[model samples]
Target: MNIGIIPMRYAKALFAFAQDKGMEETVYAEMNQLARSFAEHASLKTILDNPVLKSKEKQALICTAAGTQVSDIFVRFIEMVLHHKREKHLQSIALMYQDLYRKARQITIGSLVTATPLSADEENRMRKMLMMDKEGTLEFKATVDPEILGGFIFGIDTYRLDASVATQLKRVKNQFMDKNRKSL
Candidate 1:
């Protein structure tokens, strides 16, 4: 996510590779599950980070552990990383692939941070607003951020719209100071 260049490169390559191998869906599913697993088990990632263990061995261990739950393409992809000595970037690869897969479906991911939990009607209204503005279809995930105080902050891709009470308060304070300075 942070290293945009690297993730993009890896994601593009992986997307193409998966497509050519006729395992795009399998890869996408496996990558998503891998990302979830990485989030839930930090220690598992550390094990993958072991420099002493050869990449092939590490991948084999993961493939064996994951077993039938993961696809053959997923296992082969892991092995390819070990073969290339890029095992350390496995997590990043998974994240990048997930992003690529989502984007391919014209599904943009957005987040809404609200002062409080939004009611179903309110959430639907927001979704409608987004749909009206969106160039393509999108899926949004709302998060409750009490620090916003009252309003909401919407984020999509790299753009964020902060229409929050916290920001409104700051604007009001700045306006007051400006007016006072003008009078002085």
Candidate 2:
């Protein structure tokens, strides 16, 4: 009864069920919303795990957290999870479902971090360039972080290209420190 196994088992079953119902995409979106909700609200788990709160109330909270409207399939799946007292694992289940959906749909998640925001055309060009050597559709996001100082950092799936000035400067500083140590 490993903790990790519970979420994976529930997520796999939910994924298969959603696929059979042709509602996997809808459920995937709901799961992503749910995961984000959990991340943003640390007290959510504490509230959910309260034995004083009724099951129906918990269901309402879950649905509200997901979005204004969720698919019936998602509602039913949440009902089942609550029935089995697996509400505590809801966050993990949502994340695992997203992972399963991404893998099954061959969607590669990527992000670009730059010192400044790129224009629409520049962003599209960078996304296209990154996708050229990769497989499947890319779910790309562009974010601005002035802390990077300059250049950009691009990541796709498990690979990352750290061309940011901050990282480069750190590398040079480390090299100088090592050289000084060696001479001393």
**lDDT, residue 183, candidate 1:** 100
TM-score of model 2 vs. true structure: 0.90
Q: After best superposition, candidate 2 residue 79: deviation in angstroms?
A: 1.2
For residues 1-184, write the lDDT of model 1, one tens digit per residue. Answer: 5556665677688789888988888888777777777787788778888888776679766664444477776777677777776666777888889888877767777789988998999888877887776677777898898987998898887789999999999999999999999999
Q: Name the lDDT value of residue 149 in candidate 2.
A: 100
Clashing pairs in 2: none
Best TM-score goes to which candidate?
Answer: 2
Error of 1 at 86 (Å): 0.4
* Error in Å for residue 118 of model 2: 1.0
Q: How does residue 138 of candidate 2 score in lDDT?
A: 85
lDDT of 1 at 15: 87
Candidate topping lDDT:
2
